[model samples]
Target: MTDGQITLTGIRAHANHGVLASERELGQTFSVDVSLDVDMDTVCDDLTHAVNYALVAQRVLDVLMGEPVNLIETLAGRIADAVLAISPRISSVQVTVHKPHAPVGVALDDVAVTCRKDAE
Candidate 1:
């Protein structure tokens, strides 16, 4: 494994993911951050030898908008799985799901869930 990582941060999307009925009715903005451990030792002079971050972002967005989940934990897991499926060269992946407009009735900055997975 090479000591290199590709990070995609601040990916904003609108999704209905929460326990409250209002949350599912009126979707809110969500932010996603992903980091993939990749092998930088590979010989490359083109994008083919590296992970396409645009495709990675789209994969995350696809899962975010695909279905409604009640918890950010589940969403985080799905994102990790999706990224891990992208390529075998990816040794590990970390995914974070941010919920800024939580209905906790408390004044808070944001709530988020992070998940990490390693290739088997």
Candidate 2:
């Protein structure tokens, strides 16, 4: 990460997304963390040059709250794409999504997936 690189992290409320009937009816909350790597040299003169964590968080919330997804993986992908679309300065992105209330039979703490991408 560079000197002024930034990361955005938060938990979002999402609808249930599983083949199971019960999961479909009830929604749950999922946690998401996004790391954005950017070249801040151009924006060094102004704070705006740096990635705004608040904007990132709001964007993530918009995706999660606006759309109904079948899987957290898809949500993560959409988020990563959204971030890159919004900030061309972002050179790379790492997104991690956590589902704490997965419908697993056995006792488990949480389920999560991480995706790393380089800007095109």
Candidate 3:
């Protein structure tokens, strides 16, 4: 494995994901950050040897918009799993799901869940 990483940050999506009924009904915006640890040795002039970030971003969006979950942790895990499935060159993935509009009833900047997965 090479010391190469692909990071995608600030991926925004609108989804209904919360424990509160009002939250589910109204929905909110979510931000996702993903990092993929991959081998960069094979990457040269061929695009096929490289991980397409566009595809990775799309994968995250697909999961974010696919279903509603009460916990961001679950959503993050799904994203990590999806990213790991992208390429065998990817050794591991880190996913962070941020809920900026969390109904905490207190002043807060954001609430987020981070998850990491290793290829088996």
Model 2 agreement with the true structure over 1-120: per-residue lDDT tens digits: 254467777656676655567767787777888898887765356656667768888887778776666777887888888888777778888888888888878889899988887789
Would you list the clashing residue pairs of candidate 1?
none
User: How far is 106's C-alpha from truth in model 3 (Å)?
Assistant: 0.6
Candidates sorted by TM-score, descending order?
3, 1, 2
Which residue runs does candidate 1 get wrong by more than 4 Å?
none
Q: Residue 29 deviation, candidate 2, in Å?
A: 0.9
Better of 1 and 2 by TM-score: 1
> In order, what lDDT does every prediction score?
0.90, 0.77, 0.91
Instruction: For candidate 2, list the clashing residue pairs, or say none.
Output: none
User: What's each prediction's clash count?
Assistant: 0, 0, 0
Q: RMSD per prediction, one decimal? A: 1.3, 2.4, 1.3
- Name the runs in model 3 displaced over 4 angstroms: none
**Residue 70 accuracy (lDDT) in model 2:** 76
Q: After superposition, how far is residue 91 of candidate 3 from its true place, in Å?
A: 0.5
Q: Which stretches of model 2 miss by more than 4 angstroms?
A: 1-4, 42-45
